[model samples]
Target: MSLITFHRIYPSAIPPMRGDKSALGSLPAAAFQYCEAIRTASSFGWYVFPPLDIELKFDGAEVFCFAEESGWNKLSSLYFEDEFWREWDRFAPDDMKGYRIPYLTTLFVPGIVQIWSGLLVSTASDYSVLVRPLANVVSHRGYQVYEGIVETDRFAPCPLFINIRLIDTSRAIEVYQRDPLFQVQAIHRSCYADGGAYAEKIGLGPPDGVTHGMSATEWDGLRSTIRSAQPLRDSQIGRYGAAVRKRAKGQENID
Candidate 1:
C-alpha cells in the first residue's frame, strides 16, 4: 500500500489524523443514518490541526492576530524566510505591480488572511496532495476556506498552510490548537495529465453527452434508476449508499 505521512515541523505542531464524526455529532441519530455522503466525505481524508491558539480580529480595515501562550505571541509576528517572497514578487504579473503579499502574512488583503498549519506532508512518488477545507462542514465563524492542489511529490515534504477569505468580518475568528484547521487527501499525479479522460456522462445534455449513442432501451434503464422506480419491490431509502458500498467492495467475498 502507498503510504502518506505528515511530519511535525514545529514544537507545537500536531500530526494529522483521519477525520472523525465530530462534524456530524450535532445531527440526530435518525438523521445521521442516511448521511453517508457527508460521512464519507468527512472521513475521506486526514484532518490538519493548528500549531497554536490564535484570535484574529478585524475592524473593516485591518486584521490583528493575537496569541495567549508563551513563545507564540502572534501568527504574522513569527519569523519567516523571505526567499520565496522575494523571487515571487520579482516574477509576479504586471497587473499585480504593487501587490506583495508575503507567504506568512496574517493579512493578504483587506478581508483575506493566511494561517500557518505548521506541518509538512509527504506522499508517494507518483501521487500528489489536495489541501482544502473540511468537506460538508461549515465552521468558519467569519471566513471561507480555500482549496489548493499541490504536486507534493515534486517537493516531497511540502509545507501545508491555509488561506481564507473573510465572509462576515464583523466578529473575531478564533483557531484553537485542539481543533482541525484543514484537510489533506492524496491524488494520483496522472489525474493532472494534459488530456486525461477525467469524467464522462451519457445523456441528452448540453455538453459531454452521448445522446446519439444512447438507445431507447438504455434510456429506459437509466430513467428507472434516476426515478428510483421499484415496481417489482418496495423502494429503499439508503439504496444509493448500499450500492456505492457494494461497488466499492467489488466482487470480493470475505469468509
Candidate 2:
C-alpha cells in the first residue's frame, strides 16, 4: 500500500520571554502548577502529553526557544548540539539572522514512537497520545503565537493522518487548504462487513496495517511539497540532516 507522509515546518523561532530570567524563576512554580493541572484534567478522562524539555537559545543578545521536543527525551545530545540550532536557523526568518548563544531546555513527555507505521494506526494511537502532553508543555513553556510559512510535498508523512478519520474530511481539507505546509492525498475505499478497504486514489495500494510503506516518487513528492511551502532560509537544514546522517553512519546515537 502507498502511504502519504505529511511534513510541516513552523517558520517562527521560539519566543523571547520563554528564555528570560523571570520565566526560568517561575518555571519550577509553573511546572508544579501545570502538573497539577494535567493530573486534575487527566482525572477527568483527558489525555495530557507532558513537557519533555524546555530549550532556551541565546543568539548572543536575543533569547528564544526554537523547538520543544515532547513524548521523548527532550534533552538528547542531538537536540542540544549546535547542529540542531544551525538547522533550526535555516528555517528562521530573514530578520532573525546573526544570532548566537541561545539557551535550550528539554521538556519531558511520555510515549514517543520512533518507528514508522501506517497513517491510520499511527495517527490514531501514537499521534493521539501527544495532544495532552503537548498541551502540558505549552502550558508551562508558553504558546508559540506566531504563524510562519509552511510548505508540503505530496509524499511527506502525515503526523496527523490517523486523526483525520476522527473528524470531517471536508473540514480537514478546508483547514489544510488554507495552511501553506499541509497536504493531503485523496484515498479511495471499498466498504465491507468487517471493515472498509482503503487505497490511495493514485493507484497506491491499501495502507499497510503494521508498516509505513511508500514509493520513492511519493516520498520525493512530499519532500518537494515541504520545500516549496517553506524553503529553508539558510543551509542549516542540510547541515543538520548531514550531521544526523553522519552520526548514524558512525554508529553513534541517532534519533
Query: Compared with the true structure, what per-residue lDDT tens digits does model 1 show for residues 21-105?
Result: 5463654565457656766777888888877766676667666666454532334545333554455467768785555433345
| Per-prediction backbone clash count | 0, 43
Q: Which ten contiguous residues of candidate 1 have the minimum total lDDT? A: 71-80
Question: Whose TM-score is greatest here?
Answer: 1
Reference-based lDDT, each prediction: 0.68, 0.29
Output the lDDT of residue 180, model 2.
18
Tell me the alpha-carbon RMSD of every candidate.
8.1, 24.2
199: Cα error in model 1, Å: 5.9
**Winning model by lDDT:** 1
Which 10 consecutive positions of candidate 2 have the poorest summed lDDT? 161-170
Which sections of candidate 2 miss by over 4 Å?
Answer: 1-52, 57-121, 124-138, 141-255
